[model samples]
Target: MNAFWNRWRKQLAWESVPAGTVEGRADRDPAVGPALTDELERVLTPVMRPCAGIALAGAAESPIHSFLTGHPYLPAGTTWPEGAAGPQIFVGQINFAEVASVGALPGFPRTGLLQWFVDADDTYGLTFDRSAGTAGFSTRWYADPSTAAGSPQPDAPTPTDTVDDLPMEFVGPTALQFRHSISIPDWSGLPAQHRSDPIWERLAAALGERRADPEFVYEEYVRGGSSLLDQLRTASKVGGYPSFTQDDPRGTGSYPAADSGQAELIIELDSIDVGGWGDSGVAHLFGDPAALATGGLTSIRYHWDCL
Candidate 1:
């Protein structure tokens, strides 16, 4: 790991971005964080993005950002989140203001509280149109949480209304901790244009300069990109590229062209201390970057899967 990564890796109370690769050893680090080498800048820097890595934190005393399995800081008079089967279990929430304090992503909101609830069904109600607000999942975002007040929603679901045979229990609070990092896109998350001739040509030029054959070099570059993604992508994060157990929901079929707009990963939760997706899977929430930059929340799409 580099000195810079080593320093912050020690400061954060919870997990952190990987310690960058040590020189003369194995090239094990994700070469695309805040610190970049001139060599890396030539190839991968264009796609790197600032992201906030997440971890469990101490109990929050107020309606600040938090991640909980059941207890939710819902203001009085608000209806408990519901799905088709019935009341949904409280998922987690993101305090954009809190994200700002931890790190910054250009389009991500700086102040707000976004929470979600899902059915305790076998798949957590993440069935159909992952883009559409399906009946199994729902989100509530307070653009201005300061103006909102009350206590935790006392009627949070006990999951007795679970739609599946497997039971879903209400776990206690899991506070949130964050650290700044950089993320590079998985090829699956790129639009058609980004993955086509233009990128390949760029890769060809970048690799061709160092090798004898551009064709052979391009293939090696692609494999290297995928290898790096697999290692650095297995943690909880917000506002960065995503790592999926199956495939990216916003892959080529979902995002055919660049003009159709780029796909943005809003939040991703690995099967960690808070909850599990299935058999050691991950949860993903995607949105439109332009919408989020302006503080829009309606673009959310939810999906989860396991290996």
Candidate 2:
């Protein structure tokens, strides 16, 4: 990890997004409170969205502004290997959810919690259960590849057919405008295990370039009752009443909100010629380097949502 990533990682907290809970919604019925189902569904919906996105400039009816959703899951044994190499393992799916006491805003009688992107890099699988009392979260990260010759880890249960039933929705231009959050799981954090993986360097450099773009900005919002606040209030409320407590807000928000400071991160390879990687024109950094250093074919642009 680089300085920037290391610094942020230190501040990182691993909070489980309830798969199904009332507390995860921005607006909730204070009497009955938030339900676990509502919160979990919201998080899983976006996880189903493919990794790829396209921005075309235009109005709702304009076809140019449409986005092309990418594939949701890589086949169990599939790999993005650029050359003749072993297939990257398909671990498991990640789940997330959030909710608030009321609506997200001050004066509103609701607990507020913005949906910050969950740390998807954890090797453990997640299972969240929340009720009237407190929240109960469980995780089981798999270490060995699914195709490994030996038996799978005892802690890691053999994924069942039910895994396919898990909801993963596609967020097109329309979905982007809604109040939603996303969890990007399956990120390979170890360089030794993934040094040969070309996509890792390509993605890191791509995100770095995006972080460097002038138009690119990190955005967030304050969910006020009827009026918007200049300063963000980390409370959830509907009609000027806090529903959920700060220690336990109902709905959670992401740092780079879709329309706000968020810019779609795109990874494109010019070509994947078989023997073209060894001495590519540029030497790609595999292990770790400054995440801010500007180099490589990676590029970033602002307003891609409107593109």
Best by lDDT: 1
- Give the range of the ten consecutive residues with the poorest summed lDDT in model 2: 281-290
* Candidate 1 lDDT over residue span 252-286, tens digit each: 43332323444567788877644567776888777
Model 2 regions lying over 4 Å from their true place:
1-222, 229-307
- What are the Cα lDDT values of the candidates? 0.59, 0.20
Count of clashing residue pairs in every prediction: 0, 60
lDDT per residue for candidate 2 within 1-307, as digits (tens), equals 1332233223221122232332222322222112222322233234222221112222232211111122112224332222111111121121111112111321111211111111121211221333211111111212221223322233332222222221112222221111212212222212233324343233223223233221121111112222112122212111111111112112222113222312122211111211111122100101101111212112111110000
Can you give the TM-score per candidate against the true fold? 0.68, 0.16
For model 1, the superposed segments whose C-alpha errors exceed 4 Å read 1-36, 129-133, 153-170, 187-234, 251-262, 272-275, 293-295
Scored by TM-score, the top model is 1
TM match of model 1 to true structure: 0.68
